[model samples]
Target chain A: MTGSEGPGHQVQAIGNDEDVVRVRQLVRTAAVAAKLSLVDQTKVVTAASELARNTLVYGGGGEAAVSTVDNGVRRGVRVVFSDSGPGIADIDLALTDGYTSGGGLGLGLSGARRLVDEFELDTVVGAGTTVAVVKWAR
Target chain B: MERVPILKIGSVLLVSIQVDMQDQMALQLQEDLGQRIVDTGCRGVIIDITGLDIVDSFVGRTLSTIASISRVLDAETIVVGMRPAVAITLVELGLSLDGIRTALNVERGLELLARNAEPDTFDDLDLLGDPETTSP
Candidate 1:
């Protein structure tokens, strides 16, 4: 689903590093059109980029969606990153600082969560992982 | 996607780039810089990132790696030119690049690098001579 052609106000892209970049760009563009301040726009875009990367690197690929929220009083973007890779073994440890599974410094998941106003993670060890992040204009 | 050179001033090496550094490119650049630090026998390295408008977690982590590797190699590492917005986003994202050094510009980074360098080598190098010093 494209951002422009939706009742859900959604935009979805395959999980890949490049696709993550695209998603950030889309979020930035939409945030701008929604009249978000430059500061708020960058926050949402950067957060989206981090989550998208996690979806690609850990999830073994997934999809990302962006849309407006809160009746336009504030614009919110939600990204649902799903991956089929080995799921996070320790949720708490993974969220801790300096904890890293891959070569990363373990910032993607935790950092993305911090940047957004709402954050949720649902994962099953062998099944897959899904992360949802939403940020509202302040 | 251009390969930039690592600048050397005395015992310090400086590398600066203006691009949307992300994913593998960021990692590759960090690795290459680490190798250069070892090869050059520099005492410190400074990465001037003034022109970067955005930094993803991958790039942030790669930079942290560069700093860590620099220390292991006995070279100091500094990240400069971090825009306020970028810094705020990074902090809010909970991405802590702790243990990494930072400066405001190449000149300040060079000075800091020089300060961290072997004192004897400080007098012999000129950082502003030419950007060509960084050419691969």
Candidate 2:
């Protein structure tokens, strides 16, 4: 589908494994428009890609949202990736580096959080997971 | 994914990029690879990115930093097997890899290093003086 326009942009896609690439592209476009530096933009996109992949691989399927925020002189982008798969049982253990559930390095959540200016995570044992990431222009 | 072994060849270390070398893993790998090069006392490093379909900014910057870290340890670093699409995308995305050296293939990169090590070929250059002018 096509991404929305204006100060706030949005796009929705399936949580399939292939959608991870599209989410990255979307993050790149939104972050660049928000005036993030190339390195910062890449960081955001990479984090989003990881989260999206996790949502698809572990969570079964999910949705990703992107929006630009302006608070006075401060400007940034916020990405919220939500999924409806088996939720994380231990957030603390999952956040640890090198502890992976999907044959990965278990750096997805922590690494994604590190790349952004702000990070938040919400999950229910039997419900699902939602990860929010925010990166400001610097 | 499985953790691939870091290939060691004499004074050089060669690593094949795995598919999951993204996000935090990418960052950790960068640091680990840099440290390993120093710990091994290798003179050179080659990171083969043949498995990667996309090379984002974080990966690009990490690779560049690894190259610099290798230099700090007196080891040379070379990035090889970057797909044309990935290369073009990195340029389009405005990611600058200033201190990094790239090669089309690992073999060519190794050959380059070998050539640099031995540049003196007797047959390549003629004698400075003519044969008649030389002392008997």
Top lDDT prediction, candidate number: 1
lDDT of 1 by residue, A2-68 (tens): 1222235566665555677678777776676666666777787887887777777777877776666
Off by over 4 Å in 1: A1-12, A84-100, A123-127, B1-12, B39-41, B118-136
Tell me how many clashing residue pairs each candidate has: 3, 2
lDDT to native, each model: 0.73, 0.73
What does candidate 2's lDDT look like per residue over B10-108, in tens digits? 767898886645355666777777778768877778888988756754567678878888888877788899877566545544455789888899997
Instruction: Residues B1-136, candidate 1: write the lDDT tens digits.
Output: 5565677777678788676654656767877887887788877787888877677677777788888888888888889999888888888877778788888877888778666555645434345444455454
Error of 1 at B2 (Å): 4.9
Give per-residue lDDT, candidate 1, residue B98: 75
Model 1 chain A weakest lDDT span, ten residues long? A1-10
RMSD of each: 7.4, 11.4
DockQ of 1: 0.48
Computed on C-alphas against the true complex, the DockQ of each candidate is: 0.48, 0.07
